[model samples]
Target: MTLATLALTWRHLPAAPPCPRPRVRTSEAVLLSVATLALLLGISQTTTWGWVDPRTLGLFAVGGLAMAGWVWLTLRHDEPLIDLRSAFRGAAAAPNITALLAGAGMYMGLTLLMVLVQVDTPSGWGLGQPVAVAGLMLVPYSAMSVLGSRISLWVGARISPGRVLPIGCALYLASTVQLALGHDHVWQALLSMALAGLGSGSTFATLPVLLVRAVPAGETSSALAFNQVLRYIGFSVGSAVGVTVLGLVSGPVPDEHGFVAAMAVNAGVWVLAIGVVVRAIAAR
Candidate 1:
């Protein structure tokens, strides 16, 4: 699937506009890389290392300080890796937040679903699906996401992009709710996955449009790049949160209650994303 998508994107790619490459800021890049690595490591090890462990705390502190320094350096430099100011304002901020939230919600959901399906049924929670069946169940989600993207494009032609964000968020919110309450049956699970795909596809389709509308033509690439960064950050944070939530309820393996609780929490993330996008629009 990945290879096919890559081939398709490569085939339809547009000719590049003539633009000089931006000069590298080695110091800023190095500092930011350190922060990202440390933060990711700290988060990943929270379960294994124990959250209160000095090593974990130290890594987080170092990462935070390095991130702060990197931000300061970028604002001070004339030719920084990215123009942070423009990217963090107006229409860009909402979609970026949405990207982050979407990242978090999507990853959390994927992890939850994978666990919910495969754990032993005797645990009173999982469906006890074989690994292949579990993978097959996700096919609807992948297919629906593509359809949802096209649907977003169609909807975008008729409505404001701001409207699209909420619509997308709402779909995922509904999906999460469905899974939280009605996931006893495979059909229900499939429906939740479909809603998730639609919701995600809507946001994914609209984000680039919002980003382009927010920035000048020259800064578009940088703005999108920054947005991508936020999405990855969201993914890391979501993975951490999912692990933490499940850990709190785990015994031998996570209980069914943990899966339900995690889905509920992720649903809240969707709500927060909706609020952020709405507030950003209001701020404009």
Candidate 2:
């Protein structure tokens, strides 16, 4: 079904029942953060290398099993920090889809753009830099993300999260436009990245607010964790699109021109995201 129809349907779902919010222990929160960060780093880096020997694979398997055991032991107890029930049935499914699409749009957008920057030749507009050097070019974008995150945190404190999500959708649209109109050179790309950063910070940080409002207090963590999982799914799909599927299309084959094409697809996704958010707001 179309996103508009889904949003309309979601708006009509019965309000969720209230449940007690378990207080978070500080130690659990700290350990959770550290473990999550470490896990993310490990997962995000695996694609960089080609393969692993049997010994390395054996180590990975053992480590993963150990981590799983730790998590299970932690959550299986009474007053467990992780609530699994809420995750399965929070807000209507529309917002979940929105989260996934937005996440995919952000990751694919960056990866394809980076491809564009390094595809330079006289025939195309790329800067023709090596991947190592191109990595340096993204520093500004990362810096801007930090600034945007801080700003989003402030803005979220004052505004409804529902509003922030639409703003993110709009900013992503703006980034899409800037990249589509490539005549402006490097500044335009940088602007797109900054705009992207703002959108990313706004939408991601506040998504749980919507999730929380829709679910029982007891389900808060569970609902939010599901949302988090979807975001990672988006990230994975985006990587495949940017790194694999886009290349199969006829063009410069991962060069600037190909990147332009890939970004155009991402732009379309952004437009759909905008529609999803708008329909949601209107349905309310």
Clash count list over all predictions: 0, 0
Instruction: Highest lDDT: give the candidate number.
Output: 1
TM-score of 1: 0.89
Q: Candidate 1: minimum summed lDDT over ten consecutive residues — where?
A: 117-126
For model 1, residues 1-284, the per-residue Cα lDDT tens digits are 99999999899988688889788889998988898888888977887887889999999999999999999999998878878877666667788878989889887887788777777756577777899978976788888889888999888889888888888889989998988998777788888889988888887888888898888887888788878878887887787787678768765577768777888889999999999988887777
- For candidate 2, report its TM-score: 0.64
The lDDT, on a scale of 0 to 1, for candidate 2 is 0.67
Query: What is candidate 1's CA lDDT for residue 91?
Result: 68
**In candidate 1, residue 81 scores what lDDT?**
80
As a whole number from 0 to 100, the lDDT of residue 138 in candidate 2 is 71
